[model samples]
Target: MRISRRQFGTLATASAAGLMVPGLAQAQSATGMHSFAAPAPGKNTHPLLAKRDQNAILARIQGLMKRDGVGALVIVKPENVAYSTGYVSRFAYGPGVPAGSQAAAVIPASGNAQLFINLMESDDAPRMTDDVDVTAMPGFVFVDDGTPESRQERSATIDPLAGFKDALAAAQDMASDGKIGIEKGSLLAGLLAYLNSQVPEDRSLNSEDLLYEARLIKTPWEIDILRMAAQHAERMMSRVAQQLEPGMNALVLENMIRAAGWAEDKEYSMSNMAFQIGIGPYWGVSGSNRNYEIKQGDLMRIDGGGTHFGYISDITRTWAVGGSPTSKHEEIYDALYAGFLKGLELLKPGVKMSEMYAEVRAEVEKSPLLPTYARGHVGHSISLSPLLEDHPLFAPGFDVEFEPGMCVSLETSYMAAEGSYAPGPYNIEDSFVITESGYDRFTTVPDSLVWDGSLTTQ
Candidate 1:
C-alpha cells in the first residue's frame, strides 16, 4: 500500500506501456475501428470479465437501501446504472438515435437489472459490464421505435414515461407493499407525472435522496482504472499542447486532445471525447470551431475529459497559446496552483468534502492578485462518467467525506481582471484525486502558466 515516489513512477511507466500495447497493435488491423468494448481475441487477450465484481456493488446498493430504510431502490441515472452494472450505452441524443428513449439502464431493489438499449447496442452491453448481469443474456432488452411489442418503440410511439412505469412494475412485483425508494431527481418530469397517476390518491411514494453519497468514495479497482484514465488525459494534454500552433482553432485543439486519449494501446483507447475551451472569462466554451484561431497572446484554456474502459478523467489546463506567459497570467496561475495544492494536502480519508473546499477557498482569499471567483472548493469524486453529472461542487451542507478508495477532481480556478482591452477575464483549472496517503494528478499538466512543450510548439 505504501507506494514510494519511485514506485509510482515505475507504476506509471508500466501502466503507460500496458495501455500502449493494445493501442499500437490494433492500429495496424482492419477491425481497429471497434471502440473500447471487449478487446477482440489477440495474444494474451485480457479475459472479458463476467459477473465477477457484482457482490461488492450489490452489497453497496443493499446497504444503501437498508441504511436509508427504503423498500425498493429505483436506479434511473445512467452513471448509477453503469456503477451497478458495467454496461454503458450511447443513449445520448445523437445521430440516428431518437432524442427520447435515450438508452437507459436500471436496477431494482430486489430483482434483475434491465437495460433498455436500442437493438444496435444490445451486444455492447455484456462487453461493457463487469458484473450485474443483464436479463437478455448477451443481449439487452432492445427497444425499437417500430413497436411496443419489440421494446424498440420509437421515441414518439412508446412514451419513455411508460417504459419507466414498466421498469417500476418489474421492481414492484418483488416488494409490492414496501415503500419504493426512487432515485430522487432521476425520473423525468413526464415520467414522474405518469408514475403519480398509478399511485393511489392517498399514498405517497418514498424516493431515495441523491445516491452519490456512497459513490463519492472509489474502490481500489475504480481507482486503478481512473489512474490509467488520468494518465491518458495528462499525456494527451501534453501531446496536444506540443501540437498547438498559432492558427489552430478550438476544433483542432480539441481534436488533438481527443486523439491523444484514443492514441493509446489501441485496445483500451476511448471511443469519443468531450471538451470545453475559452480565452476570456467565460470558462464553458466547447466543441470544434475550425474557424476561431489560436493566436500567440491568447490565454488558451482547454478543459477536456476522456474515458478509458468507461471510467473518466476530467482535466483542465490554462496556458498561453504560445510559450510566453504574461506576468499577470503567471500570478493567477501560481495562485490557482497554490489553491489546488493546498486542497490536495487537505484531501484524505476522514476529511469532509466541505472542509477541503474551505481550505482551497482560504488559500485563494490570501492571493493578492486573485479574484473572489473561488466560488466553491477544489473538486469532488469521479467515477464512470464526467463530473458525476449533478454531484456537489465544494459547497456547504454537503457532508460527504473523502475516503482512500475514492478518485476526485481537484478543480480550482480564479477570475482575473480584464486585460486593459482584451476579450475579458480568464481562469485556470485542473483535476486530481485523494490517495491512500496523499493525492495524484489525473491530468499531469505542469502547474505553470508558461506552456511547456507539452502543449505548445516552442
Candidate 2:
C-alpha cells in the first residue's frame, strides 16, 4: 500500500513511542521530546546473527529443564524464541502479536526442538531462520476477489494453529512427568488453558524467571552485536543533531534518523529509538507526538537504542540547542554524571543491583543540586526491545547478583526543582554489560557535552 510521507511519519512515530521509559503521566509541557525513526527491515541476515551459538543457548535451557524436572518448555515469546533457536524469522514478531505468534516451541527432553510456525511464515522460515526442525502450518490456496484471471496465492494459508497441535502433541508425549514450562507472563489465559487441555494434566507452569535469568547475561557473540547497535545509535544521534535548523519541527530529527536507518533496513520491526527536547515533561516527540518547531537556547536530549541482530543498544546524551552550555546546565550535568559514574563502578560481579542503587542515590544526594524528581535508583536491564526487567534498579531485589553477561542501561533521571534554574529532566543514559571483573561499555557516546554543548567524537 502507498503511504504519504506525513502519514508514514505519524504511523512510524507512534510505533517508536514504545521506547519511552514508563513513568510519570509523560505529561507534556511547552518544550518537547524528539521522536526517533527506525530503519526498514532487511532480508540479508547479519553475519553475527547468522552465526549465533545454538549450543550455548540450548545448554542453558536444558540445564534448567534437568533441574526443574520440566520435560519441555513451550517457548512462544519472541525474545525467548530467538534466544533458544538463534533464529531471526520476521514471522516470529509483529505488531499486536506482542508475545510473538500464536506458535510455540515444543522443546523435548532431548535432541532438537520443534519450531511450530504460522501459515504466513512457513515459507520465510526456511530462508530466514537458523537450520532447525521447522514445522509450518500447511499452505492452502488464498483466493482474492481482485483476480482478473485468478488473483489467488497458494502456500501455508490454512488454520493458524494447524502446526501448533503437532508440537503440542509431541510435548504431551514427552511431558510424561506432567511438568511442562511456558512463559506465564507472556501467554494469554486462553492460550494457557488450551495448552493445559492439550496435555494430560495441567502441567504448564511459569518459567520465564529462569529463562530471563539465563538471558540477562550476554555471550561474547551477543555482546559484539550489541556493540554494533550502540555505534549505530551514536551515529544517528550525531547525524540528527547536525542537520537541525531553527524552526524545524521535532519530527525532523526522527525522520532524518529514520532515513539513515532505512538505508540499512526498511521494516522497523526490530529497532527502537527516541529523542527528547529540554521541554520539561513536554519534551521529545516520543510520547507526545507534538509538532514543535526548534528554537535556540532549548535543550535537545537524544535517547535512542539501535537494534542489530535483534539486540538493543540504548544510549542517551543531551545538547544545548545554541551550541553553548550555560553554567547552570553544566552544574546539573556534573552532579548527575558524578553519581552515575560511581554507579557504574559499583557494577561488579556478585554485587546486588539494589546495593548499587542505594550507593548512587546517596552520592546524588550529596550534591547541593539535589534531585527534584529523582526516583532514587539508576536503571534496568536493556533486554530485547520492549522486554526489559522490573528490578535490579529502583529498589533492592531478591539477591539477584550482577552476572558477567547481562546488559544494562546506566542512567540518572530527575527533573529540576521548581525554584532552581534546572533544565527539563536532568538525565543521561548508556548501555553496558557486567563483566567477570567490572563491566564492558557497549554505548561509546560520552556523557559530557562539549564547549558547543554537543559531542564531537567520543
Candidate 3:
C-alpha cells in the first residue's frame, strides 16, 4: 500500500515539533531553542534494489552455481532475495523469515528471470523491485469448458508454497536433469520435504553458496546510504540528550528518541528501518523493558536508526540522566570510552577484524573489575541486516576481514555499581566504517555521560 506523504511524515521525524519538559513526571515548560526544529525527513529518493547491482551479484553467484552445477538458483532467504534482486520483502518478516514460501528471483543459465510469489502477495511483490521483470502465479489455475471449442483456456490457483514450487517445476520442465541450487538455510522444512518428495530421478538438487558470498562486500551506493543513516542517528542522539532526565517512562523516552530520528527528512525510501531504546543500567540492549522509570543515577541508553536509501543505519548512545554523573559513574563511563577508542584505533582497512576485537578485549581485561561473564563480541559487519559482523575475530564464529566499504558496529560493555565490587554492565554501541588511517565514528553522542550537577528552580 502507498503510504500517503502525510502518513509517511508522521512515521518519519516530523512529529517532534516543540521542545518539551526534560523529565517525564514534571510539567515544566521547555524553552524553545533555535536548535530544535524537530528533525526533517531524510533525502534518499531511490530504493537500494532499484540500483540493480545484479551483474556483480550474478558474477558472484555464477561461481557457486557452477561449482554445484545448478541450472536454476531458488533463493528464499529475505536478506538473500533483497541482496540478489534489491527487493526487500515486508512479507518475509510477517510469517517469520524462514517459514514463508517466498520465491527466489529465477536466474537461468541464459534466459530472462521470473519472480514467483504467493497469491496474497501478488499485488505487493511487484513494487519490491523496479529493475527485474516479475510475474505472479496463484496456487493453481485451471481451464473449464467454454462455449467456444476453438479457444483453449488457461487458469491457475496457488498454494502457500505454489510460488516456489511453480518456479522449480518451470525450471524442471525446461531442463529436466539440470542441477537446481537451493539455499538450504532458507528453504522451510515443509518446502524441502515437498521438493525431496516430488523431484524426478533425472534432476539433481543441492545447496549453493551464491547469496552469502555476494553479501561480503557492499557497493558504493550502499555505503552512501549507511553513512546517511549514521547522520540521522547522530541527530537522534542530540534529541535524546535534550529529553534526558529523571522520571521519564522507558516507552515515552524511547518513542521520543525514535521520533527525533524521524524528524529528519529522508532523501530516499528507507526499507527495514529499526530503532531501540534501553534505559537505566542497560545502555546497549533493549531487553530491559520499555519506559522503565528514569531513576536517580540511572544511565539512559538511546539507540536508533533509519535506512539510507535502503542501506540500514544502526547506531547508539548512553546518557546520564538528571545531574552530573558521580565519580564512580564517570569512571565506568570512561572505561567504556577507553574501550571504544581502543577498538577504533585498531579499526582500519587491511587490519585483521580479529586484531581490533582483541585490542578491545585486552583493554577491558586490564580494568580493576574483571568481568565474570564473557563480554559479548565488540562489533560486527552490517549491510543487509543490522548486525552482520556480530562475532569478533577473537570470538568463535565468522571472522571477516575489514575492507574499504564495509560498515561496522564499535560497541563496548562494562558494569559498575556504587559500593559494590560487582557492578552491573553498561553498554554503548555506535556505527563506524574502516578508513585509510583508522575509522570514523558515526554517532555524535557525548563520549562521556553529562550530569548538570544541580537541579534548576523555576
Candidate 4:
C-alpha cells in the first residue's frame, strides 16, 4: 500500500516523538533514540522480510511497466533479483560462480510472478515470500532418499540453459503483447542469443532504466530498513569513537568497528572504515598501517558504513583525537557543517538535486577558512547496493527532484594540502529520508569537532 502524504506526515511526527513503526523499536531502544519494546518473532520469515510490503513493491513495478509500455521483465542481477523476489542468493556473495548459474525472476506487469532459482535453495527461498511461484532448477547432484516427494520434485536435466529456456517461455506467455524487458548485462551470451532468436530485437528492451525507476521511490518498509541500518552503523561508530586514544593505529580502530558490528550479527560495507590521521590527501584510504599512529592532537577522519539485511549506511565524521580542537580545526569543521546544514535545509519534496548541490556548494565556498574547498558531489542515494553511493547523486547537472520516501546521504569533505596551516581532512555525513514537509535524519551523533566521551560516560 502506498502511504499518502498526510499519513507520511503523521508517521514522521510519530517517529520524531520516539514512536517508531513496528520491527524498529528494538533498535531504537538499544540506541537510546526512542523508547520501545522488542519486536516479536516473525512466522517462518526473516524479520525484515516480514516487514516488507511485497504488494506495494510489485504494484510499483507494474505501474512503471504500464507507463513505459513494457509487458514483462526478466530480472537477473543479484541485487535486482533479491529486490524483486526477496530471495537472497549465495551466488551473489562469493567469487568464481558461473554467470548462467545465477537466479532470475520473471515478473509480469499484471499477473503473478515467477522466481527461477537453484534447487538447493528451494526449501529456504519459499520461506522468504509466498507471493511468487518458484521454479527450482537442478544446481547440484544430491543423493535423495527414495521418497515420492523427492522423485516428483526432481528435474530431468542439470543444464542451466534448459531452465533458462523454460523460464523464458513462461515469461513470453505472460507478456502482455510479446514485449519483454531483459537485463542484458546480467545475462550470459548463450542465454541472450536464445532470447534474441525467440523474441524480436525490438520487443526485447533493456530493463535497467525501468527497474531503477521503480526502485527510485522507496516504499514505507524500505525506509524503515534504511533507518535501522543507519542506526546500527552509528551505534558501532560511537563505540569505536569512545575507544580512541593516543597511539591507537588504524588497524586497532578498524578491528573495533568490525567487532562491534559482527557482535550484533551485521555486516560491514563500502570502504568498511576509511581512516586518516593528522594530514594529507588520503581521504579514501582504508588500509591498516601500523606506522600511521594517531597522535594526541591529530585530526581523525573516518568514513565508513555497515549493511542491514541489504540496505547500506554511509556516514562520516571528523574530530580531534584527544578532545582538544584548535581554533583552525573548529573553523574548518564549522564551514563543513554549514554546508551540510544547507544541504539539509534544501532537502524537501520537489527540490532538484542539482539545485541543492549548487546552494550547498555556494554556502561552503563563502567560508574564508576553506578557500581551496571543492567537491564534485555533496551526497548520493543509499540503498541495497554493495556500493555506498547509488543513483541520482547530489551533484551538478543531476536534475532529479527529491520525493517523499526517498532515502539519501548528504556529505561533504575537505582535505588540506600537506603543509597547509589547518592540515588533515574535515568531513561530515549523515543519512536522511525525505518526508512530506522536510526530511527525517537517521544518524543522531552530535556534529562536534571533539568527541564528548558520551559513550564512555554511559
Best by lDDT: 4
After superposing candidate 3 on the true structure, give the runs of residues whose Cα lies further than 4 Å from its correct spot: 1-52, 63-70, 97-100, 109-113, 119-130, 139-158, 170-178, 198-210, 271-273, 281-292, 307-310, 371-373, 386-394, 415-425, 435-441, 451-458
- Estimate, for each residue in 114-220, the C-alpha lDDT of model 3 and write its tens digit: 56655455555566454456666453333233656324443453366767777777666644456766666557688887777767544655453455555656666
Question: What global local distance difference test value does model 1 have?
Answer: 0.57
RMSD of each: 8.6, 8.7, 8.6, 9.9
Cα-based lDDT at residue 132, candidate 3: 55
Q: State each model's CA lDDT, in order.
A: 0.57, 0.62, 0.57, 0.70
Please, what are the lDDT tens digits per residue for candidate 4 over residues 321-432? Answer: 7888788878888888889889888999999999989999899889987665579899888876766688889998999999998899998877776677677777788899
lDDT at 206 for candidate 4? Answer: 88
Clashes of each: 20, 23, 46, 0
Pairs with backbone N, CA or C atoms under 3 Å apart (clashes), candidate 4: none
Best by TM-score: 4
Residue-wise lDDT of candidate 2 within 1-458, one digit each (tens)?
A: 12244544554465467632211112111023434443226444544455667667677777778888888877878767767776544655766653434456777767777777665565555555554577764546443447663355555545555555566677778777758887867866655566667764556778788787767766677777776676666655664555554566765455445543433232222344434434423443344545777676556676655555566666776666656656777777777788888887887788887887787877877878774425755778765654433334535564667888877887876665456666454567777878889988765545665424234222
Segments of candidate 2 deviating more than 4 angstroms: 1-45, 89-92, 98-101, 138-164, 200-202, 262-281, 284-288, 371-373, 387-394, 415-423, 451-458
Evaluation by TM-score, superior candidate among 1 and 4: 4
Arrange candidates by lDDT, highest first: which order?
4, 2, 3, 1
TM-score for candidate 1, residues paired by index: 0.76
